[model samples]
Structure formats: C-alpha cells, structure tokens
Target: MRVMVALIATSATYLVMQVLRDEPEIALEMGGTYEDMLLQSTAHFSPLIPGHIWFRVPKTDARLRFIDTQYGFITPAARFFTVSFNDNVITNIRMSPQIEPLLLDDVLKVVLDLQDQWRANGWTVMYPRDNPPFADTPEWRAKLRDVNKGGITFWQAGDKYQVFLDMGRFRDSKRPNEERYLITLALAKPWLPTQVE
Candidate 1:
C-alpha cells in the first residue's frame, strides 16, 4: 500500500513536470480572465494531488469572486490558495503553507523560493528597503499602505506583475490569547481594475 501511494505521487509529479516544461509561461499571466485562470490552474495543478478540486466560493462582493483550493503542490510548493478575480481578470492571489504551526523560518523559505522563481522569470525582486518598484499613484500608495501594515518584507515588480510577501502574527479570534502566524505570498496585476479600489 505504501509503495502504491509512492508510485502515484511519483507519477503525478512527473506529469506535472512535463506540463510545466511544455509551458514555460506557466506562471499565471496577467490579464487572464477568471475562466482562463480556472482552466490554467486546473490543468496545471489537478495532477499534483488526485481528488482535490478547485471551486469558487460564494460572491461576497459583486465585482470579485473568491476561488480557493487545497491542491497538493505548486512551484515553491503550497497547498492552500485563495484567488480573487474582478471584471474577469485575476486581481489577487494569496498562497500559504496551510499545514500549520506556521513557523517564521519555514514561511520565509517558501517566500524566498518563490522570489527565486520570479527572478528566474525576469522579474526584478526587491527587498523592503529598496525604493518601491511600482508607479507612485494613489492606487499604488493605498495598496502599499496596506502592505506595509501587513508586514510586507519582500516584493517585486515586473512589467505587469506585482508580488509581495507578508509575514506576521496575530491573536487568533477563535482561540483567545493564542497567537497565530500568517505568512502570505500575494500576486497582483499592476494595472488592476478600478472595481478593486
């Protein structure tokens, strides 16, 4: 039984590797519609963990529909993902190592690995001390303000992509007095829809 499970995992990994190798632009492209996003994610990820499915959550806001999943793995490897789309385009994606205890070092390692992936793909990854790479607009200012408050320690800017890594701890509302750490890697398209404002 153990051998069978290992075989399945290996076969799935190989299939995913083949897909990624065939599609160099597997990194979710900016401006892709929600359907496009879903198709791409399903095609790229469903093989990693059998039986896991991607689905949309009920719409809380008219402009955005939250799509979430617990797939087996992704580059830099994450299990949980929440994606937000507005006006048919993906506005945000948040990924985390959902198997928790959410240690600081573990989260940082994932963030760094993801940064390396972006760097390899031509993005200019930046640390917080560096000058912000985004255009200084009201929208960006507001966005950065939120990022700053959220503990953004790493970021990057590309022609169309903006990525940020946030790491912080907060008191868990459900378990009073207990601290919980959140490590989120977020991706957004630079020219986001005004509906997000």
Candidate 2:
C-alpha cells in the first residue's frame, strides 16, 4: 500500500511538471487578437469600473511611480484588472490580485487558463523561453529565480503580445504591507512609437 501510494503521488507530480514544461502552440492571424479585444475595451468602457478598463495615471504622477512615460496606465496596484494602450494601439493588459503567499501551481494554472481562452478565441499563442529582464538587485534576482524555477511561461504572438506570470513588491501608501504577490498577463507592440526615456 505504501509503494502504491508513492507511485500515485509521483505520477501526479510528474504529470504537473510535464504540463508546465510543454509550450503552448501558436497560430498566426492578421487582426482580432487579444490585443484588439483590450483596445476595444479601453475605448468603449470607463476606467471607473475596476474590471472594465485600466485607469491611466496621468504623466505627472506616473513618473513618481517609476512607470515609463510611454505607459499611460499603471499596472493594477491591487486585486484589479487593466489594459494599457500606446498611441491607440493595445500595448499591455494585466490582471493582478493580492495573495498571502505566492503559489506556483496556482499561478501556472491561471496562466494556462488564460492561454487556452485566447487560443479558443483564434489567437496564436507561443510560449517563448526568453523573457525581458526586470530584476536588478541580488535579492530581487534570487526571488525571481525561485519563481522561475516553479515554471514561468512567456507567451507571445509575434511582437504584439506578451503573456506571463510575474510578482513584485507592491508600494501603496494605503496598504500596510508593501510586499505582495502579483500575476501579470501583459501584451506589447514594439512597432508603436513610445515616449523617449
């Protein structure tokens, strides 16, 4: 009975690892990608509704948050959803929530579900191995490495889409704890003109 239970446990762990290792397939399309859906939402809805659209932190205040000038809207600060645009083009989309402790399996499941949804909607999703660097400090790098080991997926559609799971230390004056877990699903189009740094 002990051996049988061990086998089952091992099998389940292996199955999850395999699922995480496999790359999501991609399909090419001219228009109507996830990017388009976000742009449409931003144009049609109001940011006042937390889920409908992401609010832009005006340029004056955005600099204070260390947000790039090109980015009109800041990444969701709490458990909220938002999409960002650059020159009328969809640039970023994010869904983030605060959790007590970051769970790798939970984060992976969320990213996979999002990938499946976009694929179902006729978007080509590619899980790329390379991710743009974001960490600077040794401590930050160590934390990021730990997260990456649990399996991080960087899904992209050409140069226009980027979907990934990431976490960071939240800095909000109202929130008591600045450190929180974040799961980000971001999209970007490199061709669009951006503000000079």
Candidate 3:
C-alpha cells in the first residue's frame, strides 16, 4: 500500500511540472513585442520556443516570475524564452508596425530632453549576457569588450518611460535595422490623473 501511494505522488508531481512549464512568461505581450497602428514589430527576446523558458515558483500563491524577470546567470542571444538575457526597467518592448528606424536616434534625443523622464520611468542598458540588479553588472562591462561591435542597450532617458535601442550584431526581425528603438510605458498609476480623472 505504501509503494502504491508513493508512485501516485510521483506521477502527480511529474504531471504538475509539465503543466506549469507551459505557463507564459512576462505576461502576453510584455516580454517585448508591441502592437501599434501602422506596423507591428516583435519585441526583443520574443518568439521564444517552448521548453526554453522557465518560471520560478515558490508557492501556489506566488506570481509567475519569468527567468529574465529575475536576476540570474544565463546565456546571451538564446532562442529560449530568456535568451535575450534582458534586464531593464521597461520589461515589455513592443512597437507599432508602421514605425521606421531611420529617425530613431533623432527621436530619442528629443525624448531625452524631458527633465522628469528618469523619475517617471527607469531603464538599464544590458547585453545578451547581462546579470542584473542594475546596469553596472559584469554583463554590462562585457559589452565594452566589443564596443565597436555594438549591441542592444535599454534607455529610459529618452522619455518618461523606458526605451531600448538596438545597436548590435542583429536587428529586430520584424523591424529593418538593428537600430530599432523600444519604449515600454508603465500602466497608469493609481494616483496619476487620466486626462483629468
């Protein structure tokens, strides 16, 4: 009887693991892909293949925390869910389909001019191998190794919200140049006015 009970417990545990493995990381589109009026470009580290991403679960009530969402050691540019190894304040990085990369820098400069930009939002630039709690991690230092090569770097200075600039080996698949820009605005806070709310 004890042997049968043990076997049942083991089988239940295995089945539960399989089901949890399929849970979405970073919510539906927050991972990076964004949809806009003109164009619909996927965000960085998206289109992740199943079985590549994993979320840490502490208890039944704990929220799903995607691999990238939590700071840890991981590989760069992996096709897995956490492949991009992104660590930034603006978690999601979706852009409209009609957007163009030509004026990316120009637009970024203008947004940076905002004084309260960083206060309203936060962003930290990172490479594919970044290990963060912040931008000053070893992963960020690694980017300097090939400064000339260029890579994706997140920026919140551009606007009140965080933005990411693609300046690296590869460009976004949906967007043309690797110079694609990303902006992830936070949902309105409880106190913030909604157009005179």
Candidate 4:
C-alpha cells in the first residue's frame, strides 16, 4: 500500500510538471503589479491553498496587492480568509467582486480577522474617511444615507495601497443617494520571491 501510494504521488507530480510546461501563462502588458491585476478583475473568489481549484496564483507578486480596502490583503501564501461587509453585504471569499449576496445577515469573520491583523500591524482602520457613498468629493454627502448600497474596487497607486468603494441604489431602484470611499494604506509588494511579508 505504501509503494502504491508513492507511485500515485510520483505520477501526479510528473503530470503536473508536464502540464505546467505546456500551459499558457496570463501575461498582462504594462507590467501590472499585483494590485493592478486584482483591481481591474471581477473574477470569482479563489482562495489560496494547496490542491485547491480556483483562480491561478500569478507567477509574480505584481499580480497581488499587499493591502486592499479595509478587508486588508491576503498574504500570497495565506490560506485563511474572511468575509467582506459593505452595506450589510458579504463579498465573496472564494473570488473577487462576487458577493455571497445572501450572507449579508451573517457576521463578517473575515473583516474582523483583517481588522485584527491591521491593529496588530498598527494601521488605523476606519470608515467614512474619503468619499461619501453618493458623492465623489469630501464636501458632498449623499441625501440617501443607506449604507448597504455600493461596490468595491482596489488598487495600488504611487506609494500607497488604495481601496475604492462606490455606493448606490441597486439597479432599477429610485434613489438619489450614492456613496464612494477611497482608502489608502501603507504597504507594498514584497520583493522576496517566496515571502508575503
């Protein structure tokens, strides 16, 4: 039985190496760093883990961010994940921009984990810092103050990591209020090839 298991494992390893040699890589022009790829993509949730099936981890760190909105950044090698809350909505833990939709009533363990990590790292986590839900500028407040209507985007601009939160009524609704929040963080892609620190 031991020999049989070893044989299976060896054959599987060989098969994966063979496939990787033949697979086409995702190559984005402009040399986009990790943050750029995640910001522009609306791909489904893909948790980073062993023997997992989801979005492929990029070959370079430029395809991931060191920090995202208040959700914080998932270490390239970290396996655990948390929920995202915006206006009482739970964002996807398996992929990006794909909200669980029904899990808004559930507690956001992911957000809390992120908050804990941030506090451990000494970052000030707060909301309503930049743009209001319905307006782009700091001076304009949305007439409709409902918190639950919005979208989220992320990126790394210059020396800071940024999360762009946009809020509005769901499609076909009659509401004049909209909201947006852009959060900036102090972080960067780790230069080490195998380290997420």
Highest-scoring model, TM-score: 1
* Model 1 lDDT per residue over 1-197, tens place: 99999999999999998965553222344455555654554324222222233323212111112222211124433445555555555466766534353444454455556555555555564543442333335654344335234345444353455556665564556655544456666666553322210
Write down the RMSD of all candidates, one decimal each. Answer: 12.1, 13.3, 20.3, 15.9
Report the lDDT tens digits of candidate 2 across residue range 27-122. Answer: 112233344443423222333333333334221111011122222222212234444544443345445532233443443344445556545543
Q: State the displacement of the C-alpha of residue 17, model 2, in Å, after optimal TM-score superposition.
A: 32
- Name model 3 segments beyond 4 Å from true: 1-93, 96-98, 103-116, 119-148, 154-165, 168-197
Please list the C-alpha lDDT of all candidates, in the order they appear.
0.47, 0.39, 0.31, 0.32
Per-residue lDDT over 1-197 for candidate 4, one digit per residue giving the tens place of the 0 to 100 score: 99999999999999998865444222221223333434544333334344322224333222123334443443222222232322322222222221222122121233334335545654432233432222233232232223553333222232333333222223222322422222212232322122111
Please, what are the lDDT tens digits per residue for candidate 3 over residues 1-197? 99999999999999998855543223322343222200221122233223433322111111112122222111111112221212322233232111233244433442343212333433333232442122334553345234364334333322223434332222457765445433222221122221210
lDDT of 1 at 179: 41
Q: Report residue 68 deviation for candidate 4 (angstroms).
A: 12
Candidate 3 colliding pairs, count: 11
Better by TM-score, candidate 3 or 2: 2
Q: In order, how many clashes per candidate? A: 0, 1, 11, 18
**RMSD after Cα superposition, model 2:** 13.3
Q: Which stretches of candidate 4 lie over 4 Å from their true place?
A: 1-72, 75-99, 105-107, 126-159, 165-197
In Å, residue 105's CA in model 1 sits off its true spot by 3.5
Best by lDDT: 1
Candidate 1's C-alpha runs over 4 A off are 1-27, 43-80, 127-151, 170-180, 191-197
Q: Which stretches of candidate 2 lie over 4 Å from their true place?
A: 1-78, 86-90, 97-105, 118-151, 158-160, 167-181, 190-197
Candidate 2 local distance difference test against the native: 0.39
